[model samples]
Target: MICYIYDGSFDGLLTAVYESYYMQEKPEQILRKEHFLPDFFIEPIYIKTSKEKAYKVYNAIKDKVSHEALKYVFYVFLSELKESSTLIYRYLKIAFKIGKDINLHMHNGIVLSVHKISNKVTNEVHRMLGFIRFKFLASNLYYAAMEPDHNILQLIMPHFSKRFSSQNFIIHDRKREIAALYNKEKWVIVDMLKADGEKLFLNNNDEVYEKLWKQYFSSITIENRKNRKLQKSYMPERYWKFLTEML
Candidate 1:
């Protein structure tokens, strides 16, 4: 069984998909290198990231599945699942062989696995819409930082861009170590290793806003009826670190 390892980028995943299809030999499993190699006898194929091949694979999928299906694949990739690459390959192979209705194969093992990953990433995408707090930076650029469990900056960009069309901003994902920067007219992403952000007001430092937010939070909590477990389930403790209301 062939074992494929990727750099864990969407383009990289796409390139790997392109190679797998061209090679006509589907692998036993696809894994990210963050985890150590399994005890099994492994034949490794290191997936090289190439935008050209990536775009070709994208067109191949778009030829079979609707654009919406591609979006679902994007969300699934954000989940960073170890088996995501293989599952996407499986999904695409079936999709291309069959027609558009092939999406009905959602119940298939690979398709279902991909949906699970998409669901998790989609949930995080929704939460970051509300939980993220933007700080005013010099040059009129409003900025916020988060260490989201999923790679969701792109998912979160359009919402803010459409709503705040006149503003310039940046949303950094400290975990994935990338940031999306919007300059009022267009949006672009950059890695933090190349960023110019300093330790300046990285967290919103308004005392009054913090106090008012805290008061509102306390006021809203029904002490006697509070279900801490339910609250924690919805808003995990890890996410609270970057939320102003929680701070």
Candidate 2:
């Protein structure tokens, strides 16, 4: 079993997939930087981040499935489950053989698990769209920071880019130590701590948007009809960091 270890980047995972076939050996498992490996150690092959090969795999999936399906695939990739890459590898491989019905294989645990995770990522992505609080700092760049347990920032960018098309914004995932920067027109994602925190959390951009947002959030509460229990039910305190009303 060729165990492929990745550099904790989705691109690296895709590259590993390419290497899997090229190596002519089926991988027993795929893992990221922080995950534990099996007790029975196999030679761990680390795949380099190859954008070209990554796009090759991306196009393969996209050509077969709809763009929305591709998004779901990426969402599944973002799941923090231990066997995520292994499952994704299995899913994508079968996708080549079965086409769109790959998702319909609900009886298959791996496929089902990925579908469930895709929903969670999508839900979190939508929630973050409304939950994110941007601040304007010294450099006039807008920035927001979060440490989502799941990797959902990339999935949240389009929502912000569309809604705030005229403004510049940056989102940092403290858990991943990566950030996405949206210039006026386009968006680019990079490692937050790669060089400096110029456009990261506590960067050159911080304003009172958070305080204002919290104030407005508090002001809008209907005191008479406030149902603490129901509010908590709908928007649990656990997800408060990703909810404006709770922020």
Clashing residue pair totals per candidate (backbone < 3 A)? 0, 4
Compared with the true structure, what per-residue lDDT tens digits does model 1 show for residues 21-132?
Answer: 6776667766666743865677888888899999987886777677767877888777776667677777777777775766678778776777778888988889888888
Question: Please, what is the whole-model Cα lDDT of each candidate in the order they appear?
Answer: 0.77, 0.75
Evaluate model 1: give its TM-score: 0.83
Q: Which stretches of candidate 1 lie over 4 Å from their true place?
A: 24-26, 33-40, 137-140, 193-198, 202-206, 218-226
Q: Per-prediction TM-score, please?
A: 0.83, 0.79
Q: How good is model 2 by TM-score?
A: 0.79
Worst 10-residue lDDT window for candidate 2 reads 194-203
What does candidate 2's lDDT look like per residue over 124-172, in tens digits? Answer: 7766666676767676677777767688877788888898889887887
> Model 1 Cα displacement at 210 (Å)?
2.9
Any runs in candidate 2 off by more than 4 Å, and if so which? 36-38, 48-52, 64-69, 193-215, 241-247
For model 2, state the Cα shift of residue 58 in Å.
2.9
